[model samples]
Target: MKTRAITGFFFIVVMVGAMLLGAEVFLGFFTLLSAWCLFEFYGIVCSEDRKPNKFLGILTTSTLFITTACYSLGWLEAKFILLFIPVLLAIYIHALYQKRDFPFNDIGFTILGILYVGFPFYCFTRLGYITGDFNHFLPLGFMILLWTSDTGAYLAGRSLGKHKLFERISPKKTWEGFLGGIILAVLVSLCLAYYFQTIPQWQWIVTAVIIGVFGTLGDLVESMLKRSLNVKDSGNILPGHGGFLDRFDGLLIAGPLVYLFLYLAN
Candidate 1:
C-alpha cells in the first residue's frame, strides 16, 4: 500500500509536468511511452515457446509511434494509414520467401496491438493541438479524474462493496464500488472545474461520467489482456504500478473519449 501510493505520486508528477509543459516536451514523453507499450505488447504476445521477430517488432512499433508523433505535431494526417498497405504486402512476400516459417497470427497481432493502443492515444495529442496552448489542460484534467475514480473504487470496494461487478474478468470490481467511483469522480471534477475555471458545468459532468465508466473499462481491458497472455503484469517498468500500459490504460480510453466529446459538443 505504501509503495503503490508513493510510486503513484511520482508517476503523477512526471505526467503532470509533461502535459503542462506542452509542445515538444509533451510529445517526447508520449513518444517514449508509446514505444515502450509496443515493446511490452510484443513481449506478452510471444509465440509457441519461440522468440518473436525482434527486428520486425521494432520496425512496426516505431512506425506506430513515429506516425502518431507526426500526426500530433501536425506534419501529416494519413502518414500512419500506410501501415495497413504494407502489412498485406509483407504478409504475401514473407509467406513466399519463408515457405511457411512466416507466422500469420504473430504478424497480425503486432499490427492490431499497435492500432489498438497507439491510435486511441494519438487522439489526446491531437486534442492538444486543437485547443492550442490553452487546451493543454484537457488530458491532464481527464487523467486526474481517472485517478480519482480508481482511488474511489479501490477504497469503496475495500470498505463497503458487496456485489461483484464482473466476477470472472475482474474479480475485485463491484457495482457499489463502481458507483462510488463515479460519484467521487463527478465530485472531484466539480472542484477541478473551479480550479481550471473554463470548462462549463455540463461538459465537466459529461467528462466525469466518461472517465469513471471508460476508465474502469480500460482497467478491465488490461486485465483481459493479461488473463489471455497468462501473465500478471505487462512489465515491471513502474514500481508497484506494473507497466506503461498499466498506468495509462485508463487515460487511453478517457483521452480519446474526452477529445471526441469536446470536439463534437462544441
Candidate 2:
C-alpha cells in the first residue's frame, strides 16, 4: 500500500508536469521512457528458452530511438517508414546465418518482438506532435483512460470478482472487473469531455469504450508473454508494481489506439 501510494504520487506528478509543459517535452520524455521499456522487454524475451538475436535487438532499439527523435522534432516521417524494410531484410539474413538449431521461427520471434514493442510506441511521438483546439488532449486523455481503467480493474477484481475473464492468459482477471473498469473510464471520459468541451460526448463515449476494451487485451498480451517466459513478474523496478513495463503495458498498447481514434475523429 505504501509502495503503491508513493509510486502513484510520483507518476502523477511527472505526468502532470509533462502534460502542462507542452508536446515536445512530453515527446522527449516519453521517447526515453519507451526506449527503456523496449530494452527491458527485449532483455526479458532473450532470457526465455530461445536466445533472441542480441545484435538485432540493439539495432532495433537504436533505430526506434532515432526514428522517434526524428518524429518528435517533426522531420523524416516518410524516411522512417522506409526504415522498416531494412529491419525486415536484416532479420531474414540473420536467420539464414543462425539456422543450426531452430530455423526461421526464432528470427520471426525477434522481428515480431522488436517491431511490436517499438513501432507502436513511436506512435506516441506522433500523437504528442499534434496541436489542436483541446490543447492536444490526445495523449493526456489516453493516459487518463488507461490509468483509471487499470485502477478500476484492480479494485473491482479484488472486491467482487467471481468469473474468470481469461484463465489461460490471466488467471486473476474477471469479467466483472473488466466491465467495472470500462464503466469507470466512461464516466471519467464523460467528465473530461464536458470540462474540455472538445469533441462531442459521443466521441468521448467511443473513446472510453474502445480504450477500456483494448487496454485489457494489451495487458493480457504482456501477461501471456510473461507466462510463456515462465516468469512471475516482468521486472522489479517498481515496488508493489512489478516494473514500468508491467504497470504500463496496457497504456503502451492503448495509447496508439487512442491516438488513432482521436486523429480520425478530428
Candidate 3:
C-alpha cells in the first residue's frame, strides 16, 4: 500500500509537470509513452509462439504518434500524416516475406495497436493545442477530472457498492461507484470552468460526464484485454500502476471523446 501511494504521488507530479512545462515536453513524454504502450500491447497480444513483427510494430506506432504530435503542434503539414498510409501498407508487404503463419493476424494486431494506442495519444496532444494556442488547462483539467472520477469510484465502491457494474469484465466496479465517479467528475468540471474561463461551465460539465462514462468504459476495455490474455496486469513498468496502458486506459478513450466534444463545441 505504501509503495502504491508513493508511486502514485510521483506519477502525478511528473505528469502534471510535463503538461505544464510546455508543448515540447508534453509531446515528447506522451509520444514515448504511446510507443511503450504499443510495445506492451503487442507483447501481451502476441505470444512467443506467434510473434508479430515487434520492430515494425514499434516503428509504425512511434511514427504515427510523432506524426500526430508534429501536426498538432503545427510543425508539420496535414499531408504529412498521409505518409502513414504507405508506412502501414509496408506492414502487409513485410508480412508476405515472413514465414510466419497467421501473418494477417499479425498485421491486424499491428494496425490495431496503432489505432488503439497511437490515435488516442494523438488526441491528447490535440487537446493541449485545441484552442489554436498551447493552453495547458484543457489537458491538465481533463486529467484532474479523470483522476477525480477514478478516485471517487474506488472510494464509493468500497463504501456503498451494492450492485456490480460489469461482473464478467470487471467484478469490483459497482453502480454506486460509477455514479459516484460521475458526480465527482461533474464537481471537478465546475471548478475547472470557474478557473479556466476559456471553456464555459456547461461545456465543462458535459465533457466531465463524457469523461466519466467513457473513462469507465476505457478501464473496462483494458480489463477485457488483460482478462482475455490471462494476464494479471499489462506490465510491471510502473511498479504499483501495472503499466502505462493500465494507468492511461481512461485517457485513451476519454481523451478522444473529450477532444471530439471540444472540437464540436467550439
Whose lDDT is greatest here?
3
Per-residue lDDT of model 3, residues 76-117, tens digit only: 987787766777788899988887867778888888888888
Higher-ranked by lDDT: 1 or 2: 1
lDDT of 1 at 203: 84
Better of 1 and 3 by lDDT: 3
Candidate 3, residue 18: the lDDT equals 94
Tens-place lDDT digits, model 2, residues 1-266: 99889987897788777866875666667666666676677677763345667567557655766665665556767468457568656877877776547755567667666666766666655655445321656667778888888889889989999999999898999998899899999999989787756667888888888789988999999899888878777677777777677867786677677778867877
| Residues 1-266 of candidate 1: C-alpha lDDT, one tens digit per residue | 89988988888899989898866777777767776776787788776743444455556555655765666667879656477456435633554454345466655765666666666666766666555443666667777888899989988988999999988989989998898899999999998888875567778789999989988888888888889889898899888888888887786677788889988876
- The per-prediction tally of clashing pairs is 0, 0, 0
Sort order, lDDT high to low: 3, 1, 2
Residue pairs clashing in model 2 are none
TM of each candidate vs. truth: 0.85, 0.84, 0.95
lDDT of model 2, residue 228: 85
Give candidate 2's TM-score.
Answer: 0.84
Candidate 1 — which residues are off by over 4 angstroms? 49-102
Q: How accurate is candidate 2 locally (lDDT)?
A: 0.74
